[model samples]
Target: VLFMGITFVADGFGIVATDVPTTKTVVAQVASTVFGPDSLGYFSFQGFTALILFLAANTSFNAFPRLAAILAEDGYMPRHFAFRGDRLAFTLGIVLLGAISAGLVALFQGDTTRLIPLYSVGVFVSFTISQAGMVRHWRAERSAGWRRRAAVNALGAVLTGVVSIVVLLGKAPESLLVAIIIPILVGLMLFIHREYGAQARELEVRPEIVVGPPHRRERVVVPVPALTRAVVQAVNFGRSISDDVICVHVTDDAEAGERLRERFERQMPGVPFVIVESPFRSLVRPFVAYLDVTGTKDPEAITLVVLPEYVPRHWWDRILYNQVTNQLKRALLGRPNTVVSTVPYRRES
Candidate 1:
């Protein structure tokens, strides 16, 4: 309010000093005329105004992180946002706000006149929602003089909502962004709320259940792609776990399967073969089918599927190969009493 009063006075003097009346009142231009351009007074006015603007910018810097923390606590945002940084600050929120502000400043090319209208629309919309919520709260409480409180909030909401619409329409493109973004944000919040509610329902503990560690049940299934050193090592790992180490292979050709079995004879002598012929050439589907067979074969057993993953040196090499380990893991996750394990064999450059 003080700033507004000062600006109002300065602007009145600014028009007469400049003589040519312009609707777009530049703050620096007004300050220059009011306090004599390039003088101590002009610079003082600028310095003070800059300080106030800096403080105003800090409002977001301070507020957003705390808001983010609250949202995060309520599961509206990522849990990481609830954590404080080294200096006990909401660093993620601060950094994000800074980035957003920088983008907006760059977008408007630091045009305060253009920026204000867009800023005002979002602010007014927020005010409207907040006031409306208060009115709802007051009505629900039904305390002494609740009617007055509700009336106050209802009036504020109506005024702000109307102002927001007017400002939005008056500034076409700028307020158009607000109209689009506000709805998107509301939708996102609603989605988060639904997800939280669903998770809560899913996680609710039943009244009766025996929670205790019992006798162990495990069945390790090692996938044999080839007679490579990596495959040999993975099979060796499986052998160490139990005497019933089964080697499963999904082959496109029966001839290739026979050849691999011959190679396995020399490489892995003891491990039994469970060869699956896949005519479709779909790795994930065949692997998932094998898991289903294992699941039904011994429904009470823990089917541990161990995969041998080759870690190549180059990024391009990694990209060239199918990410079968991750794909297989994702596919096997839904299977009951089953676990997918991966052993990475780093190849020499």
Candidate 2:
């Protein structure tokens, strides 16, 4: 109604030129007169495209999370993502969606006109599938009164499927190659992932692993890098749980190790600094070897590896450094009888 009224007003006034070849030309003229001639042509299109993108952004931020939560409840995604955060938002889904959208924006150079055909294809496909699903669901109910509902759903499915077909036929020759490719690829991945997850669950350890009580707390070996505030916090955190705290530091060079050891002795007086030799300059291997050796010596003791990590507030800060903490965590998870905990300190802005 609002759009119709606006069209009526534009037609009544001489503002919109009927002689214009395209809506883009009219938009350019209007925007140029209102804003400036500099803000015409592609700039006008870009501004309008940005506005639509902003509106569509809410679909991923709000609608996608709700849909994901529903899928998660039906065992599609991880249950953790379904939970609401302190800010009453699905933080996990929101973050994931934001990351994906940002990647798309970067990939397409933020030209939403290029992205729209692809977006429309997915929207239509989903609409068609959803309508078909509803038809099936209504049919399965199969009551005397459900005949009307089933007919309505069947009609809806037909209409949506036709629209989807029309969109595919009309847009494919245009800039919709990505639209067709992405959805098919995504659907295949989702199918493969679902099958893998199902197979994994089926082959999982039985009553022995699932029903039994958790193992008792064993010895904890905390490897501290150096006597920094972060390391101090990690050591204190580890000590709180278990008194068996052995700080291991891997050194590629002997001289560097000696210098670090002397500094450690001065800063952390009583804490023993065990130096591990690494000729390959690998940080993960020596600590893993230490954990293996400790586990062999005391099989009953649980090893708690406390790693102090610095979390950067800005995304650019992460690009400056190699993510050693993430690599270390991944390596630690591969080891047996070891639980890794990260104590993160946010870098001061």
Candidate 3:
């Protein structure tokens, strides 16, 4: 209501500033006298339109992310979009929406007059459907004499449906058919995806309930970075499980590779450190390839890739180091018979 009132006031002020005569008979009216009255009116309309578009864009930016999060929680979208980033709420969704809006703005050349009728029709249709659904839900519950609630909701549905029909009649011939059809297609796709996901969930395997003498043992793969306390802890933990333990390292440079090998030889005499030299200077591919080779060599082995990452007290410290550990973890997760774990090292503040 406050937004509506402010918009109304702004629109009124714009009209008054451009169309209304300030003085009864002033000889000092310079600007309006130079440009024609119609020109001034057009300029004012354009300015007001720009202001409304700016407001609409801001509102969309705020609303789209929240909507995306809600959809993600409901399993309609990827789970990553459900959480807020450090500085922005639904950062990925907002970026994606911005890119989409940019494409749309370019396609339509930012013409609101052409877009308004197409926009309102779907809104009214959705309103009508929602009200109808509410009416049906109230009718279904029967508690506290739901007839009254149903009647009220039915009235809302009727009003919205009438408005929607009027809008369709007024706008369909005027390039709104394409807009309406696009949304219908999108909604259909969403429905199909939801159904498919539901079926997939039903077909998914449940964890076993068998007890005693586990059929398989876990394979622990410790990522050998340096002879640090964290590395020792990881290796010790992996050894404690009485399972196969392997150490992995990727070499992008020969000097760094030889240094890491010597450090492993000196610090971790018992543990075997396998280094895969990366021709492309990429960590993910080499690490994943190593996992594949290990798995092929011992098909029964469960490869657990343990990565040690430094937890910085200050955010700036994080900016200096490239996130190779996180990348390696993600890559290992994509391969079969492989599990990745992270051991965090906290730096002194």
Candidate 4:
């Protein structure tokens, strides 16, 4: 009430809505007008205003993490979001929200005029959702005076929903982004939930479990483009892991393939070398096809694909080399019982 009165008085003094440089500085203008600019009263009010703004900014930090944790629990978000930090805070949520907020601010160049519409639309939409949810809860419960409670919630939902529409229309192309983004986000959440359900079904443990003989056989398939030091390192690692280690090379040129085969036989004797001929000169697809054939041939044994990666001495030098290791890893990520490993051999210079 006191703040309302102050606002009214500020308006009467022509400091609220008149000739204001910016809406954000209106409070400071009012404080300066009511009490002399250099007065303690003015400074005190300015301090209070700063604190209020600070609290407003902290509001999302309080609410967003808990909301994210709930979504994660429902499998709509990543499982890591459900984890709490040492201080029992949803640390990832906080960090992610902070980064997003910073990005939004930066994207708009800190233009409140542009940002406020998005914020208003978001707030009213949330209000409508909450009110509608309450109405549904009241209807489900059907306790005494449930109709009255539900009616009140329904009114709130209608009013907020109308406001959301008005804001979106008034805000035009800016708010259009919200409309597009909300549906995309909803679709993404649904997709995540479906994926979680499928994964849960696949990994579910059952009571009809029986102890079987130990399967100690693992085939280590190292994809070596050339017989370099990096290939040697990966081959050595693969040999340590399994005796059934083989080097597979894919090349469009038969001559080059035979040359690499001879080099492999001379350098690493007793190791099996398989040359995959790719007339199309494609690297990842042909390699993946070979793995598929091998996997179908021996479904019982685990296939470990060790990719040898050469690490550049300088970070900027990385862009010079094609990232075949990452490409292969991404391609074989969903392959059943196939493990992808990269042994990075760092260059000295």
Query: Which candidate ranks first by TM-score, i.e. highest?
Result: 1
Candidate 3 residues lying further than 4 Å off, grouped into runs, are 1-119, 142-159, 172-214, 225-230, 240-243, 249-266, 274-287, 297-300, 312-320, 323-327, 346-349
How do the residues 148-224 of candidate 4 rate in per-residue lDDT, one tens digit apiece?
99999999999999999999999987787789988999999999999999999999878798768767469999988
When summed lDDT is taken over every stretch of 10 residues in candidate 3, the lowest stretch is 23-32
TM-scores vs. true structure, each candidate:
0.74, 0.55, 0.56, 0.68
Off by over 4 Å in 2: 1-62, 77-124, 175-182, 185-217, 224-284, 297-301, 307-330, 342-349
lDDT of 3 by residue, 1-349 (tens): 8457545655544422232334411111222344444586545755665687799779988988998898777766676888999996789889998998787677767765556666788688878888999998997888797999899989999999899888878766644664567678668658856885888799877678445676666788876656778888778877887557777777777788788888888977877777788878777787777777767767876677777777777788678653887677656656776676777777564
Q: Order the candidates by lDDT, highest first — what do you get? A: 4, 1, 2, 3
In candidate 2 the C-alpha lDDT for residue 321 amounts to: 48
Candidate 2 C-alpha lDDT tens digits along 117-229 = 66777777788778788778878888777778878877887887787778767766543675557678668657755875887799888766656665766555656556688
Report lDDT (CA) for all predictions.
Answer: 0.82, 0.73, 0.72, 0.89
Q: Is candidate 1 or candidate 3 better by lDDT?
A: 1
Can you give the lDDT of residue 315 in candidate 1?
78
Please list the residue runs of candidate 1 whose C-alpha ends up more than 4 Å from where it truly belongs after superposition: 11-26, 78-80, 84-110, 139-151, 212-218, 226-244, 250-270, 276-286, 292-302, 309-338, 344-349
> Candidate 3 local accuracy as lDDT?
0.72
Candidate 1 — worst ten consecutive residues by lDDT sum? 16-25
Error of model 3, residue 260, in angstroms: 6.6
- Model 2 TM-score (2 dp): 0.55
